[model samples]
Target chain A: MDRKDLKEKLLKIGDLATLPVVAYNVMQLTQNPKASAMDVGKAISQDPALTSKVLKIANSSFYGFPQKISTINNAIVILGFSNIRNIVISAGIIDAYKVEKSSAHFDRTEFWKHSLACGITSKIIASTVGLKNSEEAFIWGILHDIGKIVMDTYIHEEYSQVVQTAKEKGMLIVDAEQTYLGFNHTTVGTLVARKWNMPPALLKVIRYHHNPVLDYNSLRISSIVHLADILCRTLDLGSGGDNEIPIVNEKSWDLMNLDKQTVKTIFAEMEKEYESATAFLH
Target chain B: MNKNKGLHDKSASQDQIDIIEQKYARLKENEPMKILLNAAKEYLTEKGQEKNGS
Candidate 1:
C-alpha cells in the first residue's frame, strides 16, 4: 500500500487515541476541581492490572515506602495522580509495542526499551528546564518514534532492504525511508498524530524531533525529544543500527535551562539510573 | 517518585521476574536478535514448513 492508503489504515486503527477506560477516567479526574484522593482511587481501582502495577511500583526502591499499599484508594492518595498517570501510560505503551507481525527492519523489544529510556530522559530534562507537567513530556517521548511502526507496516514491504540501506549509508531509518520510499517516518507520524486529534504541542514534537536544529516555533519541546532520543541511542539501550548520534544543538542547549556542566552532571546520573533500569532486563 | 513506590510493593519477586524478562528482551544483544530475526523470516517464508537452514 502507498503512504496515503497506510495513513487511512492508521486513522482507522484509532486504538492509540482511544485511551483505555482507566486512562480516560483518570484524565477526567484530573479535570475535576473537587477530585479527592478517593476519586482518583476509585478511577484506578476499576482496572485490576493498573491497580497491581501501580502498587508494585509504589513499593519499588524509588519510593522506600515502609508500609504496604493495599487498595487503589490509598495508593492514589499516597502516590498522587501524576505517578498514576505515568504507570498507566507506561503499561499502555508496553502493550501497544507488542508486535505480533513485526517487520524485520524494526526491533520490537529494542524499540520499546529505547522509547522508555527516551521518555524517562525527556521527563528529567523537561523538569530541569522548569517545564510544567514533565509527565506530558514523558508521554511525548514514548510516542515520538511511534511513526516508525506505521512506516514499517506500510512502506517498507521489503523490510530486509530497508535495514540494509540504513546500515550501508549509516542513516537513521527515517532518512533511509525517505531516500527509498520518497517519504519519511516523521511526516507520516505527524499525519498519524493528526488522525489521533492529539494536542498541537505533541504533533510538533513528533514532526521535528529528528531535526531539532531546524528553526521551529516548538523548538524547545522538539529539542528535548530530539536530544532524548539520541542519548538513548548513544547509550545503545535499544538503539537500532540506523539511528545516529546527533550534534548537540546550541539552541536546544539554551532552552534546556541547564548549562553544559549541569547537563553533563544529569547525564552521568541518568547513565547510572538507566543502567539500574536496564538491569531489570538482566 | 515515592508516590509510585507504594504501588510497586504489590509486585512480588516473580512479578519482578516477569518484568525483567520483558526488559531483557530489548537489550543490545546483536547475536540473539539476529537469530530471532532469521527464524522469523524462515517461518514467514516456509509457510509453517521446515526451511532450508533449520
Candidate 2:
C-alpha cells in the first residue's frame, strides 16, 4: 500500500489517535516540565490495569530492585519519570497491538518473546557501550520489528512469497523484503513510524534497526539495536518473523567498539539472561 | 525541534490532518516507516470499507 492509503488504512485497523486515554494522560503528565511523582501517580491512578502492570514492571526482577515497590507513587518516585515513562509506554503499547497467530511460519507467543529478548539484549549492549539511554534502546529493540507484525497480518496470504524468499536466500528477512516486495522491513518500519508520527530518532532507529551501515550518520542507536537483534537471534531468542539467521550487522562491532572477547562475553551474558527472560513469556 | 506532536503520533490523529496528506505524497517510494505503518493502515481502510460496503 502507498503512504496516503496506508495512513487511511491504519486508522481503520486501529485508531492510534484514540489510544488508551490513560496512556494519553500519562503522556501529558510526563511531558510536564515540572512533572513529579505526584503528577505521575495521579495520572497512573486513572488506569488500574496499566498502573499495576507498570508497578509490577518497576519492582520486576528486571530492574533488580532491593525492595518491592508497593505504590504507584513509589514506582514513580523510585524509577523516576524517564524510567516510568518507558515502562508505561511498554505496558501500553504491548497491549495496544492486535497480534493474532499467523496461520503459517511464526507462532504468536514466540514472536512477542523475540521482541522481549531483543529488547533485553539491546539494553545489555547499550549499557556496555555506554549509550545515553539504554532503556530507550531496549524499547527500540523490542519494537523494531513491529512493522512485521502489521505486515504479516495485512498481507498474510500474499506475502507468503516474501517469507519463503528470505528462507531460500538464508539472509535477514529484510533482504528478502527488498528483493521480493520491493522494500525491506526497515524501510517499511520507517514509513509506518513516520505515519504514526513516531520520534525521528525512533524512526531512524527503526529504519536502520536492521542496517547500521546504511545509516552512517546516526550509527550508534540503530547499530546497537541491529547488533542486539543479531545476538538475540543467534542465541535463538525466538522466531522474529523468519527463522533463518540473517547476516549480523558487522559494523556494530566497530560502532560499539566491541572486540571478539567483548562480543563473546556479552553473548554469553545474554545467553544466561535469555533463560530467565523466556520464563516471563508465559 | 519544531515540537510538532503531529511529527510524533500517527497521521490519523485529528490534530494533524496535513501530515497524512504529506505522507500520501511519498506513498510509493517504499520508505521504511511507511511500509510498516501501511500494513495496519491498509487493513483498517479495507476493514472500514467492508463495514461500510456491507
Candidate 3:
C-alpha cells in the first residue's frame, strides 16, 4: 500500500482520536495561555479515573516529590500544567489503546512495561544532560513506539506475521515492516501524532526515534528517546514486539555525549526506579 | 549526524539475532534488571582497571 493508504488504514484500526473527554478537554485547555490552573484542574476532575491516576503518579516514587500531592488541583499546581497534561494524555492513550489479553506471541503488558521503562529512563537522561523541560522527555518516551501499538491493534494478523518474520530473519521489526507492509511503524506513528495534534517535539521523536539522524529540530529529544529505547530494550524492560536489537546509530549515540561513567549512573538510577515506575505506570 | 538507515543491515544473521533473543529471554525469565545492573558494573570495573593499567 502507498503511504496515504497505510495512514488511512492505521487511523481506521481504532478510534485514534478517541481520547477520554476529560483528556481531550484538558488538552484543549492546555493550549490556551490564559487558561488557569483551576481550569485545567476542573477538566481533569471531570474524569474520576484520570484524576486517580494523575494523583497516583504525583505521589509515585517516579516523580519523587517530597510533599504529598493528594488532590487534582494540588497535582496540577505542584506538577505544573504541562506535567499534568502529560499524565492525562498518558492515561488517555492507555485507555484509547486498551489491548486484548496477550496473544500466544505478543504480550501487551510487556509492551507497556517497555514504554514505561523508556519514559523513566528518558526522564533521567534528560535531567542528567541538563535539558530544560525534562518531564516532556518522559512523555516522549511513553509515546515513542505508539506506532507499533497502532499496527498491532489495527492489523493484528499482519502484525503477528511481521513479528514472526523479524525473529525468523534476524531482522528489526521496522525492516520487516518495510519488506511486508511497504511503510514502517515510524510512518504510521508520525501520521497518528499529526492527527492528534501532538507537539512538534513529540511528533519528531515518534517519527524519527528509530532513525535519529538529526535532520529535524527536536534532535535532542529524539536522540534522548532513541538512546533510552535501546537501553530499555537492552535490559529487556519489556518486549518491543521483537527480540532483535537495532544497531546503535553512531550519530545518535554521539548526540547523547554519554561517558561510560554516565551510563553507569543512568543504569544505577534505573535500578532504583524501574520497579516502582513499572508498578506506578502499569 | 548520520541519516536514517532503516532497521538491520542486510548481513545480520539469524544466528546472531537468536543469540540476542535468547539472552534477553533469559534476562526476562531471571532478574532482568539484575543482569543489566551487573553488566553495567562489570563495564565500569573494566574501565577502571583499564585506566589503572594505562
Q: Which candidate tops TM-score?
A: 3
lDDT tens string, model 1, B1-54?
A: 121222123233224334333433445544333332233233223322232333
What is the DockQ (computed on Cα atoms) for candidate 3? 0.07
Best by lDDT: 3
If the candidates were sorted by their DockQ against the true structure, best first, what order would they fall in? 3, 1, 2
TM-score for chain A of every candidate model?
A: 0.78, 0.82, 0.90
Instruction: Put down candidate 1 lDDT per residue, A1-282, tens digits, no spaces.
Output: 565765565565444434456765675676578987777777778878767776776666544568988876666667777766666655654554465645666666667677767877888788778888876887678778767765555544644476678877766677676776566667767876666555677788888897876736778889888777755654445654364544445567566655444554455445455544542222
Please give the distance, in angstroms, between residue A262's alpha carbon in candidate 1 and its true position after superposition. 2.4
TM-score of each: 0.68, 0.71, 0.80
The candidates' DockQ values read 0.02, 0.01, 0.07
TM-score for the first chain in candidate 3 comes to 0.90
What CA root-mean-square deviation does each model show from the true structure? 13.2, 16.9, 8.9
Worst 10 residues of 2 chain A by lDDT: A10-19
The CAPRI class of candidate 3 is incorrect
TM-score of model 2 relative to the true fold?
A: 0.71
Query: Which tens-of-lDDT digit does each residue in A20-124 have in candidate 2?
Result: 567656766765788777877888888888878887777666666799899988887777777787677667766665445555654556677788888788888
Candidate 1 C-alpha RMSD relative to the actual structure: 13.2
Q: Write the per-residue lDDT of candidate 3 for residues A179-271, one digit (tens) a residue.
A: 888878888888777777777888889888887885466677788888888777765567777775555566766667777667777866764
